[model samples]
Target: MQATRMISGRAIPWGAKNIDTDIIIPAKWLKTVSRDGLGRGAFESVRAVPGNIFDVPANQGAPILLAGDNFGCGSSREHAAWAMLDMGLQAVIAPSFSDIFSGNAFKNGVLAVTLDEVHIARLMAVAADGAIITIDLENQVVTSDRQDRFAFAIDPFRKMCLMQGLDEIALTLAADDAISVHEARQAEDAPWLVPAQG
Candidate 1:
């Protein structure tokens, strides 16, 4: 996972509501355990349309996505987050999100910003114009070159994890020295609990 203090780029203005995990990355693409190449499968169904936003050249590789309410609403699949990262999206802004999806996204180092519908609509308009948008995690705000600024709230712990580029594994590894010391102490204090060597 990469440390992300700020993300600024043209956003994909797909504000469709109730977009589920299956829609983000169809089940057919979930057979593999690897997260790589999921980008080609991201929004697979939507991309099948004649002129979907995901297929638009201007929106290609945009680091931010502007979505409507209930984004990532269905299944508890973590693949949704994986697909988004594979597609090069660093953050998703919406009126609301599925709790499970939000947690999965956070764990995968993707930022999910929740704002009111009015703010989301404003961003949709800005995205339609292909204007650049900036999301500053440290400040907990999203801003546009047009002077549009929207403040958002995030869990302090999650914010810290993203800013520090600490995934669950990294977080656990950070306490390695403490864990080693604790184990050594236990070995000395509780010899009966320690397994005998072969």
Candidate 2:
């Protein structure tokens, strides 16, 4: 996972509510075991429509997504996070989000920001005008070039993990010294429990 402290870029202002996992990447695209190429299938149904927001050239590769309430709802598919990452989205700002989806996004190194409806509407307006939005994870605030600023709350542990770029594997590895010490003590206390070497 990449460390991220600040994310600043134009945002895709797709304020449609209740966007589920199926709408994000679709089940048919889940056939692949790898995360790569999933972006091509992301929001396929919506993109099918002419002049959809996701298909807009200006919004292409935008690092931020401004969405409506109840975003990322429905089935818990980790693929949704992968698809977003592949699509070059690093953060999603919404009034609310599905608990499962939010967890998945965090584990995948994507920032899921929750703000009040008023702030969301402001962000949508700015995004519609193709203005840049900045998310400062360290400061827990989102700002726009037009002087709109809103503070958000995040779990401290999640914030720490993201700032340090520590995924589950990396977190476990961080305790390697303690684990080694415990194993050594166990070996000394119970030699019979130790596996025999070939």
Winning candidate number (lDDT): 2
- Candidate 1 has an lDDT of 0.90
As a TM-score, model 1 comes out at 0.85
lDDT of 1 by residue, 1-198 (tens): 678799999999888999999999888888997878888889988889978897789998999999988999888889899999999998999999999999999988899999899998898898889889999999999999889999999999889888988767877899999999999998899978867787
Model 2 C-alpha lDDT per residue in residues 57-138, reported as the tens digit of each score: 9998899998888889998889999999998999999999999999999988999999998888889988889889999999
The TM-scores, one per candidate, come to 0.85, 0.85
Q: Which pairs of residues have clashing backbones in candidate 2?
A: none
Which ten residues in a row are the worst by lDDT in model 2?
Answer: 162-171
Candidate 1 to native Cα RMSD, angstroms: 4.5
The parts of candidate 1 lying over 4 Å away from their true place are: 170-198
